[model samples]
Target: MKKLLILILLLPLLFVGRQVYSDDCDTSSVSNLNESQVKEMIGKCQKNWEMIVNAKKPHEESLRQMEKQLAAFQARLNTIASDLKQKEIKINEGDALLGKQEEILAHRVRQFYIKSFYNTPLLLIFSENKSNVEDVVRVLAYQQATTNDDKKTIIKIALYIKNLEDKKKQLETEKNQLSSLQTNVSEQAGKVKKLLTEANAYQVKLEGQISQLSARQEQLLAEKYAGSNYPMSVGETEPSRPVDDRTIDPGFRPAFDFFTFGYPHRVGMSQFGAFGRAKAGQNAETILKAYYNNVRIEKRDNLMGNINVNGYGSKSFEDEYLKGIGEVPSIWAEKGGYEALKVQAIAARSYAVSYTNNGQGSICTTQECQVYIGHNKGGDWERAVNDTRGVVIVSNDTNEVIKAWYASTAGGYTRTSADVWGRSTPFTKRLADLDGAGKAYEGPSYGDSPWFYVAWGSRSEYGNSAWLKSEEVADITNALMLYKADGGTLIHLSQPDKSNGDTWSSDRVKEELRNRGKNPYNSVSDVDTSSWRNGNGITSTVIIHGDAGDNTFDGGDYKYVFNIRAPANVHLKTALYNVEKK
Candidate 1:
């Protein structure tokens, strides 16, 4: 199988036909750029892809927020529904009481007017005139109630009936108002869903583009390292999958490889659960314990001092290093509102230790490692750093500094490193990182950074899907075909488990065509939307479309079943996305 995969990867070189180059990334047309320049362009494109992928964090948060609001509105509507029913009952009772009171008080015609209101004579209507007046007197005479006081008593009853009618009207008005509020809430909720869906669609589009770009790079890489051993095995995990879910989404379609979940991640997943646990009276240790795996906090001597980060000479003291971490805002621990700052401090310190490039003695001050600013004294950073002095994260199994990678926030379900990085370590496990209210951080549209640490300066993961340009799929498809023609792997993909399935590392649709013994994707006729899965998470829909006029097999009515699973770095954001015809 491995031998077959290696041969399959080289299939592209056998058919170096006339290349139909992509307008965007036309590598074949360019000779001005040397190898370095090509690498530079690839790097820049990869960076852009990363940015696009991370862009989903805010939209996800927004959608999450809207969902929460929707839920609240639903709850309120339920309450209003109950109250409206009660109001109807009360109004009916009031109507019946008013009728009875008006009937009983008919004898006091003139007095009723004086008691209920002085000016509103129109509101007080009489059923009978002079003939009724005689009857009224007769009735009163029979009861021996001809006195003026008796007339006032009957008038009071009439006034009481008027008040009942007034109350019934007020209740009805309230019911109408509540009903209006319900309608508005429902509308807003609908709008939120629309916005969320659009945001999610945008995420999908971005992933698709990234997937295209990544596939371009992957093919280039395959061609670059076909004979040499570079770990593009038939079963190796995609390097960017689980670890880069924070960004670098590969349009991971489940249908691409029998609809399976690909490499997953805990890198960009949420810590809201841990925050929630802490807020709910769980101690910092407990919170950390839940999120971290097989880890023990150990007091250690300051790591080697004066590390070089980026271009600047970074001071090496553990506390000073903690002080310099610019990734998290300084105000977190100083404000004392969010104890998560301390946890961050410890994680930052541990990360610094892990990133200490033994060769260069330098770490990147950028997101490539963790952001670092020299001696940030803002907020209680000093205090927080001091309190957690000599603390370093150690893997219980390895007894070394663990890769204490953390992001601004996890969506909710902290991914396992195994899922994200394609290789799980004992310490890189998934945690029920929840919110203080015990809700999953990634649960719904609770978009606002409910975690206090994020409110200040921490960047949260954003977006649903990156938007794909109309021609990108075609361009990418064309590129993949070219790559295949150039003796690169064009058919069959390496599964996460080293198993083989029909998929190009870059273009699944093309792989599907090849599986049927056809030419690589010459053109994307249309993207099927019927198998669409709407979004809250990454995996969305199944795609069924017909692609005809290929090199080997010209056919139609092909159905792609996406594994409704979210493995990482594969390009199926939704089951089926839009396709551009060339």
Candidate 2:
């Protein structure tokens, strides 16, 4: 019995020992793997960062060389244009001069013919037959004068005609030569333009790379010194742990956010397959200035709220902006992407879009459709993303919400001079809160604007065509409830009507929304829209007024008011309550 008891105790001890040993081995393996991964990431990041840095120096030098070449070429082209203009003018003058010479030659030739053939021999014969010698001599003198005049006229006409014809031929030859030279110079200009375009594109790419490297450098410095300050909790998946200095690891590899949240430089159609725009030889300073300036503008306009404006200087922004604008659009168009812009808007539009169209989780933080994991310390690449907000709208299939969009922050509205032909939608208008303070719905519920009085049910015409709060709810119930009581519009704006009515039909409204394709819920909302969305996490709501005909509202006699969500107003609201658990 004593031995049995002892054996039991010993067996338990043996099991415990084995468990500890196994745990230690597993830990060792895990640590070793983590250390190796960190080291590998660090090496790759460093290589890429260094390569970008080295690339910039050469890129800048190449750009300077290209700029000089471009300047010379442009100057030569300008000279050619000027010379051609002058040559054309001279040709015109030459033609006029030739005409005058021809006229003079013709007159001289006619006079010569009359004197030489008809008068000269007759006068000579008459002089020989004269009775008085002195009189005969006088007659001979007259005849001699006529003959000499005729000979002189003939010689002058021949020389004049020959000289005029020669001059005309010479002018024609000179004109051809000038035109050929002009053509050659123009062709060279086109090539220089292409070069400038390539340089500009290369420069942009280099700068972006440099910005990324600098961000990485900053991240490394931060990691080496101060560890990431954000906290992690239990149940958190893939927690961001502090960097282990003992082990070398590259920080998180920055992801490519495919969403185009910010406005990038416009690229022309032809530049799609061309070489890098900055590679063509645009100056680094100019390209940098443009990128930063645009970043600044976007930041101010609430488009690129995530960009770090403090890192760049005004001069840099100006230089880059000019260079980018001056460059050919083809290169950037082909290679440029919206990754930077999407990252920037993450801060501006947090939790706006769920992670995926497919319902994997309740929410998504991935950069795909959700907010970007912006500028956390210990991450690589730090410059502000280029402006991309407000340029495009993010919408769902139903067109209920503008899930997200891009906009430009630059001033001097596009409608002014150069961008006159551009899209006329104003950033302020797009970004403004025009409906704030109940601007359109200030009147009493009964008298709210005639355009959208349908909410009150008083023979209102406006509410018939719009997407009601709920299809099941009658207009008298939901539509009127939204009126004077809440002072909110029941109807929303649709594409301008083809007919004379203020609102489109329900079908027409849906079709218009689909065609317009704006994500109405994308704007800052008081409450989340995902809760009410269908399985796809997308919903569209339309606010419209009455149709054109009066069958429903007495044939247009009842003018219904159009209720729209004020740009400044929040579409939804949220509240949180805390409870104590004992």
- Against the hidden reference, what TM-scores do the models get? 0.38, 0.24
Candidate 2 residue-wise lDDT, 1-582, digit = tens: 234224223421101111111111111222223212232333344444334334444434444544554455456556656665665666566666656666665666666566556445556577655555456456556666665676665566556656655665665565555455445534544554554455445445534443444445434323322322221111111122222211322122110000111111111110111111123332322222222211212222332212222222221221232112211211222234223223323322322321212122233233222222322311111222233323222222332222222212111010111121122222112111012342211122211211111111111131111112222111222222233223222232211222223433444433443445421121111111221122211112222222211112111111111212211110111010010111
Model 1 regions more than 4 Å off: 1-265, 268-281, 302-310, 314-316, 331-337, 357-360, 432-438, 442-582
Clashes of each: 85, 78
Q: Candidate 1 overall Cα lDDT vs. reference? A: 0.45
- Tens-place lDDT per residue, model 1, 1-582, is 234224323422111111211124334433344322344455444444344344444545554554564465456557656766765676576667656655555646545444435323343244346565556556545444534555565566556656655665665665565455446545654665655455455445544544454455445434432332211111111111222222333343321122211112235313333334434555556666667787888878746656666676656555455676665444333223255656666776777777773224677766557766555555565666777876878888988887787653453445565454333468766554445565553233332232211101111222232223223334344433443344233223222222234333445545654665656543444444322223222223323232443222111111111110111222331112322221
